[model samples]
Target: MTPRIVYLATADARGHLMRAQLLVHALRQAGAQVDVITTSDAGQRFLAGFGIEASILSHHYAMQFDTRQNMLRGASNRNVLHYMVHPARMLRDLLRLRRTLRGKDILVNDSFHPAALFMGILPVARRKVVHVYGGSLREAVLGNFDGTKRRLFSHLFRHVVGWQIDAARARLEHDFSYAISDHAKGRDCSLPTPVQVAGPPPADGLNSAAIYLNPHFSDTNLAHALCEGIADAGLAAYCVGEGYAGNDGWVGVDPNWASRAAHAEVIVSAPGMAALSIAVVYGRPIILVLTEQPEQASNAKRATALGIAHQTVTWRGEAHDFRCQVRQAASTLRRMVPAPTAVSSGRLQAQARVDAWTVRLLALCGVQT
Candidate 1:
C-alpha cells in the first residue's frame, strides 16, 4: 500500500505553512502520496510554488478584532453565525473535508486543532495522528469554544474532546510527532513535547543583511518601514515577503529567500521557527521583532536566551531611528570581526530523526523506492 498521508497545517502564519511545505516536499521526494490542507489563501500559493497543491478549508472559526488589528478573540460563537447562515456551503465543505480524511494511512497535524475536532466526529480509517506541535495546545483547545458552544454541544462535546485528548496522547507517544526547536521541551509554556527537530538550512548568502517578515505585520507597515530604513543606511537589505513589495524597487518577496538569507551578515525579522533556523545555520545576528502570538513569542524568548538574537518589543519608530538601529547592528557585526557560530547537537539529531521518519513512513506505505 503506497502510504497516503494527509498534512493538515494551520495557515494562520507563514512559518507554519513553510514548515509544512518543507515536510510535504521531503515526503514526495521519498515517493509518498501526500495531500495538503490549509486555512490560508497565501498558504495555498506558498505550497503551490513548491509544486504541492493544497485544499483550502473554509474555516468557520471566528476571529474577534478591534481597530488596532489585534486578535481580541479566537474562534467564538459570535463570529460563527455569519458563516452558519450559508448552511448549504457549510454542509458541503464539511462533507468534502470528511471525504478527504476518511481513509488516509497517516494524518499529520501541524498544530491544526480543527482536524482533531473532525476526527472526533468523523470516522477516520487508519486514524494515526502525527502532530507537529508548535503552539499552546491548551489555548488551541480551550479557545475554540466559548460558553455558548459548550452549552449548545452539551455532553456530546465533552465526549468529542475526550477523543481529541486521546488522539493527542497517542500522537505524543508516536515517533512521528516533532517539535521544531531543540529547546521546546524546556519551555514552561503552551508548547508540547516531541522529537526536537532543527530548521532547514538556507542557501549560501552574502555578508549583507536580510529581513523576512510575517504578513501579520503588514497591518502596521512596520516590515516595510524597517526595509526602507535599512536600505537608507546604505546597507545591503533583502526583504522577503509581500505587503513590503516593490519597496521602491529595493526588494521583493523572492522564492529563493533561503539563498538570500544564506549570504546575509545578519537577519531582521519575526521569530518564526523556519526563519530562526536559517539564522541558526551560520550564527547570524538576528534582530527579532516579537509578536504577541505565543508560539512566536516563545521562539523569540528561547532564541534570545540562547544568545542567538537581540529582541525588539515592537517595530515602531521613526525612519531615522530605524535607520540608526540598522547602522548600529551592522557596526556591531563588523566590530565582532570573526563571525561566531554554533549548532545544537539536538538540532542535528532532530534533522536526522525526521529523515528517518520519512523513510519509515514510506516503508509503511510499502514503497521501496
Candidate 2:
C-alpha cells in the first residue's frame, strides 16, 4: 500500500509551496499518496496544476521592508500573538487532518505550522516528519549579526533566538529535517534530521526565449532595475506571478513556472530557494539580485561565489554598472555551455538522499517503504 503523507506549508509565499509541490511530485512518483495542507487559495490554485491534493488552514503575514538594515526594525519581528490568535481553529484543523489520514503513515511538515510544534504532546502518538526547508536559524541569526547588528539582536530576542533553534532541533530529533543547502548545517552540529547537500537548480538551460522575470516576493526596487535593463536592451520581457504588477512586461499573471520557464532566455530575479530550484530544474541561467532577507542574501552570495551566475546588490548606486553586468551576462549566456555529466550525477545524488529520507520517515511511522 502507498504511504499516506501530509505536507504542511504556508500559502502567503509561493516559494515554500513550490518546493512542497516538487516534493509532492517526487513522492507520488515513488508511490505515495500526498496531501498538502497550507493557508491560501492561491497556493491551492498553484498546486492544482501539479495534480496535488491540498487543504487550507488559517494564516497571517507581515509585510517585508526593502533592506536588511530594516530587519532590526520593530515591524520585522515575528508576532507570537499571531500564532495564538487562531489556536483553537488550528487545533481543529490538526484533528481534521488526522481524521483525513486515519490509516496514513506519516506527517511531513514543511510549513512550520504550530501544529508541528505541538506534536508528541497530544494524547496520541503520531508518526511525524518535520522537514525544515530554510537554513539553520543559527545561520540566519548569525547572518543577522555581522558585528554591528549583534548587539541589537541580543537586545531584541533576549538572547533567546539561538535557544529557540536549539529547542526546535531537540523537538525535531525524533523527526526528519532537511536543509536546502550545506551552509545551513554545521550550526546545529547535532541536528536530529539527517542533513543532505541538495543545491538549487543548475544554471544552463537558458536560450533564445524572451525571459519573463519575477523575484521570490516583492523586491520592487530590484524588479524595477531588472525591468529597466531588459527594456532598455530592447528585449521583450514578461512578468508574472506575485508582485509583477506596475512593472513593465506582458501581463501573464499566475506563474506557470514549468511552461513560462521554458521560454525564458534568462531569469533575472532575486535568489529565492524555490525560485532557484525552478531555475536549476529547468536548466535556466539566472541573473540573481541580492535581497535583504538573510537567507536570500546567503543564497545570492553562495550562487555567485560558486560562479553559477552573476549577481548585483539592490542598493548599489551604479545603474550603468548594473546595466553593463546584465547585458554581459545575457550575452555570455547566449553561448552558454552544455550540461556536464556532473549535473545529472548531482541530481541523482539528491534524489537518492531524498529517497533515504522518505524511507526513514516512513519507518519512523511504522511503515515499510
Candidate 3:
C-alpha cells in the first residue's frame, strides 16, 4: 500500500523549507503520497517558489532577531513561552494537527515545532512520528548554557531534550560528518546532510559569486559592502534573499540561486545547514557571514574544522571594515586550488545518503521499497 505522509516544517529558517522540499520530492518520486504543512505564509511562498504547494498552520512561533541578525534570546524565550501557553492558539492548532494526522501513515517533523512536539506526546501520535534535524541543533541547545553560570540548568535541559527527542518513533540526526554516537537505537541514526542535486551549469561559464542571506538580515549597508567587496575582488556577484528584490545591481531572491551557487566560483552566505550542504556538495568554497546565532556559529566552526576551504566574516558596526574583510576573504578563497573531483564525489555521497534515508522512511511507513 502507498503510505500517506504528513510533513510539518518550521519556518524559522529557509533550511527547514529546503529540507522539506528535497525530502518530499524524493518521497513522492518513490511513490509515497506526501502532504506539506508549514508554519507561516512566508514559508508557504518559499515552497511555492520551488513549485511545491504547502498550507500554512496559523499557530507558529518565530525567534526574535535584531536588524543585524543577532538572535535576541530574552525576546525569543518570551515569544516561545507565549506561543506555548496561549490557550486559543494552542488549542486550535492542536485540533487542526489531530485532524491532519488522522489516516496518515507517518508524520515527518523537520527540525522542531512546539505543536508537533506536543502532539507526539500522545500514544497514537508518538508511534507515527519521524524527526529530522541537524547536529548543530543539539549543540545550539546545549551550548546556550556553556559557560560558568548555569551548569545545573544545562544538565537538566540536556536530559529534558534527550527525553523529548525519544518521544518520536524514529529520529534522523544529520551532519557533515558522523562523529558522535549516543547509542539511542538502531532506528535513530546519524547521516550526512541531504541537499538537492545541482543541475547542469548554464551555457555561459561559471564565473560569478553567489550570495544568499536569509530574511533576518536587513541591513542595507552590509549589502552595499558585499557588493563593493565582490567587485573589489574582481568577481561578478549574484545576490539573493528577502528585502534585496529590485535593489540596484542585485539579482534578488532568485529561485535558481542553488543552481547559481552550484556553478559559481564561490558562495557567500550565512552558515545555515542548507547553504553549507550545497557548498559541500558542489565543492564550492564559501564565505560565511556569521552573527551571534549559536547554530550558525557552531556550523561555521565545524565546517572549518572539517577542512572545508572557507572564510568567516562578521559585521563589526562599520560597513567599511566589513567590506575590507569580505574582499580579502573572497580574494583568498578564489585563488585556492579547485578540487577537481569534489563535485562528482560529493554528489555521489549526498545521493547515497538520501537514498538510504528514503528507504528507511518508507520501511517505517510500512511500505516496501
lDDT (10s digit) by residue, model 3, range 1-369: 888999988888788888788888899999999999998887888899887899987744778898778999879878877887988776778788889989999888887677777766778888887888888886676555567477998788777666667887888888765533434236687866777766666565535788988888778898999889988999988788775666765654556777778778889999988888888777889999999898888899999889987999999889999999999999999997557776667667667756766777788898765
Q: Write the per-residue lDDT of candidate 2 for residues 1-369, one digit (tens) a residue.
A: 667777777664556566676567766777778777877676676677657778776545322354322233345444433453566665666667567556766666554554554553343423343435456333664344344556876555544443333434222211122234433222132222221233433244322333433323454554566556765554555566445555554343443443444345566655656555445544556766554566667777666655664435354646666666666666666465435553445455446545554555454445665
Candidate 3 local distance difference test against the native = 0.80
Candidate that would win on TM-score = 3
Candidate 1, residues 1-369: lDDT per residue as tens digits?
A: 557887877765666676667667778877678999887677787777767799887666434433222344543435544554566645655566568866666666666444444453444532555555544333344444445556666456555665564444234212112333343221121222222243345444333677776555454345555665566546666666554556544343455665456456667776666666666654556676654554556667676666764535353445556556655655565343324333355446445645654654454444654
Scored against the true structure, residue 90 in model 3 reaches a CA lDDT of 65
Which has the greatest lDDT?
A: 3
Question: Candidate 1, TM-score vs. the true structure?
Answer: 0.71
- TM-score per candidate, chains pooled: 0.71, 0.67, 0.92
Question: Which pairs, if any, clash in model 1?
Answer: 205-262, 205-263, 206-263, 208-265
The residue-level lDDT of candidate 3 at 190 comes to 80
How well does candidate 2 score on lDDT at residue 122? 46
